[model samples]
Target: MNLTTFLVYCVIVTFTPGPTNIVILSSVQHSSMRQAMNYVLGATMAFGLLLGASAILNRMLAGILPSILSTMQIVGCLYMLYLAYQIFRMGSAESLEQHPSGFASGLLMQFVNPKVILFTLTVIPSYVLPYYSSPLILMVFVIIITVIGFLAFATWLIFGSVFRSFLLNHQRAANTIMALFLVYSAVMVSGLL
Candidate 1:
């Protein structure tokens, strides 16, 4: 196992703009720091859970991955579109409160987020499992990957926080861009790209 290759892949995939990152950016721009942190915490937990599940069930999942992926794709696409609509019309405290970017939503989002789903499912099997089959080793890799995911989420929050003022100043434009990104993500995950 080439450590550099694994590290690079993990970094690139996690750090890239995806549904979760975009939502984090939107959360920071439209909500408070506490709210964003809640979302981050939820996302991190779900990410860790997914990684652990993948590590333990990789072999079992191999046979049914196709069917599961198909269902996930549809659910994920619909969910993303719903999020896009919410962001696109973001205004007023009622709307913000109604669509709170909190822990529960963040946790649920990861379960259906195809980008994250694919990454968590494939990374271990590709990079860790082949090299180390021991339960202890796999657990260590899962923790490491989870940390990477948490870092990625935190980075997006920081970025959004840093640009919060600018984003607020151009709220409509910012929301539009973020919504568009989410739509693009939905399309890509839908296998239409």
Candidate 2:
């Protein structure tokens, strides 16, 4: 509830690089800022939904469907590996002829992301617990976290958008970066398993 603690939580959740950010950055390399913004919006909505769901179902989920969480994590890890393969195998834009919209992809990706669930289940609740007795207070905490998440993600998307041209110009280097990111994602996903 304290400002210091809230800020610390935000920093940890928003600033650390994760699969979502990596994917957004990759999208930016092939799409426009507008598309990236779409991804951000979808991602932000997912965060809010997760936060609200955690508020309502934390106890029930923990007690009845704990294995479900583990299954989600494994599935998410496999998906990340799949994404890595996609990135590495991607053909040039001229060959592909169409760029997928980042927004739609971003929105859908959040549904399967294990990190988002982990964050909602773990970090988000801590910020809300102090205000548990009051509905208004809890809502306020969720709103604050949601807003901060949106802003932080927007910043990253904008950064990637602005630099997308540079990435496109250097296709080889960009692919190399993508490969590295895929490896990083795989390692992170493995930790969950």
Candidate 3:
């Protein structure tokens, strides 16, 4: 396997300004560190499971993906819209108590995330398959990428936490920026981006 290329792709896709990362940042800015960590754990675990499932069902995925891909995209788009609305409504605690999206929500959110599915499908076939097609190796790669994904979440969370003071001082600007990212993510998922 092209370890450098795969790792680079993983880092870009996992850490980029997508729905999950934006939400993690927003969560840290609006809520507690612990709350954001819950989301990270949930997203990380769900992504791992999805990656493994995709690798194991690679052959079947080709046929199944076409049928379900649009539906997943639509669901993810709508969910992103909802999240965008939530972020837009964010304000001071006294004016608007913005609660972090909980662990279960984060876990379920990963299932319909277009980026995750697309990455799993494309990366396994394009990168991993050429090197090793064994089930064991695929599973290992899935686990590795999942851990990488978790680190991505941690990075975003830290980025947000670092800006906690700035966000507190300029809550409206922060919320608007985060909300815009979510809307951009929705557009990307809907294939308009």
lDDT of 3 at 35: 83
TM-scores of the candidates are 0.65, 0.59, 0.64
Off by over 4 Å in 3: 59-99, 161-193
With candidate 3 superimposed using the best TM-score fit, by how many Å does residue 173's alpha carbon deviate from the native?
20
Best model number under TM-score: 1
Candidate 2 stretches greater than 4 Å from native: 59-101, 161-193
Give the per-residue lDDT of model 1 (tens digit) for 1-118: 6576567656756765567877887788788989989999999999999999988896345345735545555655666676577667866222222246999989999999987887
Task: List the pairs of residues colliding in candidate 1.
Answer: none
Question: Which structure is stronger by TM-score: 2 or 3?
Answer: 3
Q: Give the Cα-based TM-score of candidate 1 against the true structure.
A: 0.65
- In candidate 3, what are the lDDT values of residues 91-149, reduced to their tens digit? 54323335466688679778888767666655565456545767788788998999999
- The candidate maximizing lDDT is 1
TM-score of 2: 0.59
Total backbone clashes of model 3?
0
- Cα misplacement distance, residue 130 of candidate 1 (Å): 1.2
